[model samples]
Target: MSNITRPWWKDAVVYQIYPASFHDSNNDGIGDIPGIIQKLDYIQSLGVEVIWVCPMYASPQIDMGYDISDYEAVHPPYGTVQDMEVLIKETHSRNMKVILDLVINHTSDQHAWFKESQSSKDNPKRDWYIWRPAKYDSEGKRGPPNNWRSFFGGSVWQWDEQTQEYYLHLFCTEQPDINWENEEARKAIYQSAMTSWLEKGVDGFRIDTVNMYSKPMDFPDAPVQDPSTPWQDASLIFCNGPNMDKYLDEMNAILSRYNAMSVGECPATPDRARVIRYVSAEAKKLNMVFQFDSVDVGQSKPSKYDTKPFNYTLADVKGAISRTQSLLDGTDAWTTSFIENHDQARSVSRFGNDSPTFRTRSGKMLSMLFASLSGTLFIYQGQEIGMINMPKDWDIAEYKDIDSQNFYADALARNPGNKAVKDFAKAGLQHLSRDHARTPMQWTAASPNAGFTGDKVKPWMRVNTSAQDGINVKDEDADATSVLNFWRSMLKVRKNHAEVLVHGTFQLVDENNEKVFSFVKTSLDGKDKALLVCNLSDEENRVPEFEGVELAEAMLLLDNPWEGRIYLID
Candidate 1:
């Protein structure tokens, strides 16, 4: 028998909450900490063990709170510091853990550190952020230091005339990348941001872009991805940099002292071995990291905005899942099972059918497929009720996400007066915009705001019209066979068979089946086994035959016709 003890997070189910759109208590048009406190009971009813709330930190909202201006303070629109404390206490009182989004890769340009750093070249805080002198062209015109493109759009460097220098920003210009290479800055981050929250009784964190802390010391130009644009994709050069593991080790050391769990958002890292090093128990870094293979299925190289038509098949989806499922095999590392989050579009729309005819069935199928996977499970807000992408009729002006807006603007500027280019860009936004995930959560069919806020007040984002078609929580909660109810049942099933479902070893059974995703899970002790067969298409699919396994002896444990069928093997 093994003496190793499993962490609480290993078998846990995490429900991700995008605070801005989750629920609004004060009818203030925005969701807040107090609103979350009021919904704790509802969240607990989902059988989730943890709540990973997106950043509610003090910010200018340039990147929707990813650009933190004050590490210790709460965003006034979200709530006061006192409200955050109550939220933590209330969550703990329910015997559930709460993890906040940790976005330390960059800080709002308005951050006191960055403000001081930008004041003058000789400022004591000048080294807190990455700053470089402007490069001169042949004609002596000053430009950014490198040709690296920002994740949102244009150049990664933003010029500040006050200091006559350009500051690095991997994302939007308003968010400046921190100099993690600076020891003093790192120490300050550990003490002021992470340690402060842990001491405040917060459980853990869902670290954003955790692998992006370090960068090459000498700035280098990225290879051009598009001949039309001057800037190039820099993700390959910046992500998982030289000091990434070293910085993670330091962060992990602090988290260890508090016995806290960490799930890092690691993008542009496709190497399974590299991800293992980040999450391996022996490495003492992150507990698990969110991989992007499944989400980046049809996206064009370098940019999600430059997407291909939705031509990806079930095999593509299964292949991504198989790779992620096997990532930690024979190792102490763990993985996170998720298909939807704050940054990604709804899973029902992206992976499963979300039309009026098949939404509920497909949603339940996806729920069962992910809930029974061999790792920690995560369900995004509104996903349990089969929420989908934004309405196709919504105008481009209705899209509020900076990433989507910037891409659309840039696309238009590149091909002015080209109707085809404009239409293509609009289609891409409709399919993949982050705003689709940011829409207000649908609680009921009430007009104006779908009960997310008072009908008299407008929500920060438009509520999906699907709420009127029996997709809201209130309608689904009452329907015994609704997707919401199925999720509840599926979660119970996962908990009841935790050993075989959560900690089991996974093996892909029907490797080449285009429409069927069939897999087997065997417990570590080799005593219990379960077979899960899912039909990834709208049409019915026959379960594949397994060698030496008798279908006659298999007992059906759970079944959803769309289909997610699990059988206990004798």
Candidate 2:
């Protein structure tokens, strides 16, 4: 790689492309490799330098492409390995780097390795997965080996009649945990999984649940929260275990050998000190770690954050992001800033004006905030069009994400019954469904299906009905002042002022601006400066705090001033 292209990652902007919904290559009503090729120009026009393709691997898609059956092949639905090579080559030709989603924590139970691992106790690969004998009561009633809960809403175990033992699965039962403690398993995963892809000249990885590679030796009973619930396992016990660094070191050594870039989707947010230490420059584990404090904005007591209802005023969002930036200061703790991805609700629906009134400004507010932060920003598919959370009126069957569906069913299973299950159903659709984001990209306003794929054939997931009027990408692109343009302008500003935005110290300007989330980013010399103020409120509101700064040439850098504006203060 040329020096210019080699270090380009440090300055590159990563646009996350969800392949299944990015574009339809064969008009098969699903996005594919050829479609990604067709859309490269569009991505380049937006000035993106990296394309983070989120899993195009062969799998049962038990966790929507998170489970891997074949580490080195492409799913037939997406295309051939040749197609991926073409995509990578085309991306490189356009000066854009390519990154793949590295899911090493677990693999499809159908994977040959897992199949062999579960064959019998005497199998050579028997210890290649987290397997244990089922627990039995005095009466000989059998249950999971431990009281762990699967994230998909069940006990984290599946009984195997062949071996008369249960295997653990943190996600769907079809996806079992890989025993990283097994040297053969680790070497197989590293060589066949990371090394092969890295050798293809692709950039690094986004390690899915990276910290879950390690586990607790004793599969203990979980503490009770909602007691009537059948099971619970505090993820902390197994995730980010005592062996975290050892595992990361090994993973990093391979990635480093290939000079690849890496980031860890670490859900383990112990504290600022812990986060800093884990992501610190000397760690040699990853380039960055995605702290979900922003995404998981669910309500929590200071001591615990798992109960949900992450209600946040604009002030809360500002505070959380501001604090995260502060912790990463003076350190090499790179961050992955984003609004929507495979997890969480869409930003438009959750924060901005998905409700019709505040959509444009609110969407603009979130974009400006995340883009301005000092980190490698990841703009999820359709976020450029300001896609919102799923709507309440949609039928329950429209859902495809197993987790949210499981959550809804589990919420309904309580004996005395869940309070406001209907409200939660409404909120879950509006605030947490991954299906809200997997819908096809609305590329053209005039065509049916908004030219995403086509109404002629059904999309795997139901397209958001709102795409008809408000969310078409073509319409927004033509309208220079559209929410899409706000994204364009924000990218432009970041590129123009890269030094101040990417390396400057980030400080929250006003904590009490309920409507305006303000921050000032300053260069080392303090000569370079930029002020970001976003209006997250529904109605018109001026930034009461930034009103003090006197200006000489306050050019309007960008504005969604339906009640928010970004003035280039002089």
Candidate 3:
């Protein structure tokens, strides 16, 4: 193997903060940029090198912050533009980098550009967004241009009565897709919005739905293969389209000029070959890519919203992780090692035991697994303390995520008076609701707002009451054996052995063992090797004693059932 120079971000760990749920400053009931500023020390203490703040940009809050209205300005509830500047400066002062979540696939319908585009068919900005004439049947009945459906359900095309045309929106109707085919629109996005932020000194950006920017020139009607979700497999039409590489090359031209890094949030088929092309050094597109293989393990056929028995066995977990590690082992493209984020349920609750007896152990085990991987590690807010899913039995009224609400509505409307649909929808919510991850951060146990906001204001989202009892930061920080400390310790270990964990070669050990998921990582120099082992089950299990390896001389890293141990192999 040849020696390769690694980038600064390769050895860094990112902590994702859902801005709305992090911390509410000024008693506004909503978290703001200033609130993140207040918690800088706490974040730094966790040993993360990059803070990825989920979009705090101006929006109508349709799909949370993903529906970007004003890219250059901060949302009013999230503080002023000045607050964002302060956040950047404060993060830098702490010797850490800041990654802003950039949503460029679409823009809020309320954006000035979109508003003007819809004013008239011949408006100068009319071509800024995707527009097509409504197709008519033999009876002259008006309908959508194609059978493409929105990710949020219903038709992707929205009819504009005033303009007498239909605009494409892959997400909510309020989020109109930008016309990437339009050279002017592409220039505006790259020059105006992205460049403005790069100049603001942000380290990099996490591009949301990066692959969905380009669309095929010929709009084709999607075949209805699954009635549950006709649009689930329709990603090939929009994701990684013909002009995707061209647009990314242009984006890289701008990003490389600033010497910045880019992590593309691409949800493509779990094909390593397809993903590596996006972030390969030769590709010059992105610094890393977040794949959905691990997160989409138990997703049923056709639709992710459809409820499936959560009987995902240990083999399924190992297959997803090992396959990714094996494929990207010697490649230039870097993988993002993450268990949970703003879009998924809490990791402990999803993959491990969230019960009081094993919450800490399971959380620590999952953390150790990702930390020892051969790429950048991401820790979502509250993940450090092993935050579990939202409280059980919570009603739909308590959920605020647009995706969940839309899924429920579609399920109900599709099968009115059908108890099966209602039961399935509720079951899906219990296990897969985005709200499970969007709940307010539990900072302290005491108070009406869990110390996330002042006593008078109710937080935008409900705080997990379970967190207050035993999982809050205040409680975890004081306990030496807490999951919080384990995370800090694991992060410190990764930093201490950057060459091995960040750029090392990954090899799975005891591949067929259903009770233990273990691997050995060798440093680039091949001088230092670390063997990490974990007990995947709740019951006690023994780590297989390898034929050529000896443990008597090994240094035990973690001594627990969930987090087994990491030894310095001779």
Candidate 4:
């Protein structure tokens, strides 16, 4: 027998819930802890073993709860701390674990720590956050400390009139970067925020932008990517920083005490070996990390708001998947399998055709693609019913995400009086904005709000019109061949063949195929084997022949017109 010891998370399927859009129990136009509590039975029916709720902590909602002002308290809009405790208990009663979104990389400008840090240069909490003196130009004009651009837009450094100094904010100005280099600050974060939650019965955390905790102390200017713009993308300098490993080790030590699982949001780091280090079992840093190579395939630039789409092909996607499949072949490192999340646009709209004729077929095909991969599976809420992107005719005002709003404002300012530039930016946002994923969940066709809330009350975000066209859970759950049902069947197949589907060796077949993705998985003991062949396009494609496998003798396990075939070796 193999000597491998698998962690509980390895076999668990995670369901991510964006609380603001999941389900509103109080008819208050927002989804709260009680809302989630009401839907525990529905989630349990999906066969998911863990629930990863997005940030519902006390926040100003500048970044939609990412700008946390208080870690111990729940946002009043979401519910009370007592309500959260009941949620944890309810989820556990269903034999499911709970993992909250940990946004320790930064805190809201209104956070008490940031308020104290900005009070004065010599305050006791001044060192808790990064603050530097302003840089002066040749003309004596004061400017930000560095030329690094924020992920949301504008300069990464925001000038503080109170302290007469500039502070770093990798995201929006309201979210200030924490000083992980400070020993006292790190301990305080561990004890007050992390330890307190784990003690309250949370299983673990889904660390938001975990790789951005550390930064270069000297704060050097980023290399210019576009000379036309004043600021430059500083992802290279901010991600995988000098002290990333050390900080993760310190954080992981706390998690080990409770045997908690950690899946960090690690973006922009493409080096396979470097990515592996974050999840290496021997390092004991993180249990797994979410990588972005596969999702970044179609973007022309690092900025998701770029006006032009890249010349990416199906082969580019295949290459990314192939690389990730074999990334930790001989090591004990682990990775995550996901396509849809709160930060990304819907996968069916991006990867497959989302048109009227092919939406359901293509949605099932994409589900098969990810469920067959070897990693901890993560299914975002509403993805089960095949939600598509926002309507093409939506006005810019309908987009509520801060990132989308900032990009539109900057694009208009740069190209004044140019309607063509404005139209192009708007189209890009339609195809790539995070708001597409932030739309309220579609529960039924009974109302415009999709039954997420009462018919009289408006939801926090508009529900997609497609919900009225049989794309909601109530309709799909009743249809045996619906996309929602296909997901249930596919996940069951993965669980039934865990030996080959989860821990088996992955080998790509016909890597050059433009329309088909084929791979084989063999059990570790070499006793069982399976082959997965998927037709990524709408048209029919022939599967390429493998050198030694006999197709005639294989037993067909699962088959669908859009979804490819899975065969077991006899």
Evaluate all candidate structures by whole-model CA lDDT and list the values in order. 0.89, 0.77, 0.84, 0.88
For each of the candidates, give the backbone clash count.
Answer: 0, 8, 0, 0
Better of 1 and 4 by lDDT: 1
Better of 2 and 3 by lDDT: 3
**lDDT-based ranking, best first?**
1, 4, 3, 2
Give the alpha carbon lDDT tens digit for every residue of 1-570 in model 1.
Answer: 234478989889999999999999999899988988988999999999999989999999988999999999999989998999999999999999999898999999899999899989999899999999999999999999999988988899998988788999999999999999999999999988899999998889999999999899798998876888898988889999999989998998999999999999999898889999999989998999999888887776556857645758877887888888887689988998898998887888887888899888889989988987888999999998999988888899989999888888988898999999999988888888889889998999888688899999988988889988888989888999999999999999898888888888889888889888889988888888899988878897898997788877888888886678898886
After superposition, candidate 4 runs with Cα above 4 Å error: 1-5, 309-311
RMSD after CA superposition, every candidate: 1.5, 3.1, 2.0, 1.5
Lowest summed lDDT across 10 adjacent residues in model 4 is found at 302-311
Q: Which predicted model would earn the best lDDT?
A: 1
Candidate 1 vs 2: which has more lDDT: 1
What's the distance in Å from true for residue 223, model 1? 1.8
- How far out, in Å, is residue 335 in model 1? 0.8
lDDT of 4 by residue, 254-345 (tens): 99999899999988887889988999999899999988878777774546867554347888888888777775588888877898999888
* Whole-model lDDT, model 3: 0.84
- Output the better candidate (1/3) by TM-score: 1
RMSD of 2: 3.1
Model 4's alpha-carbon lDDT is 0.88
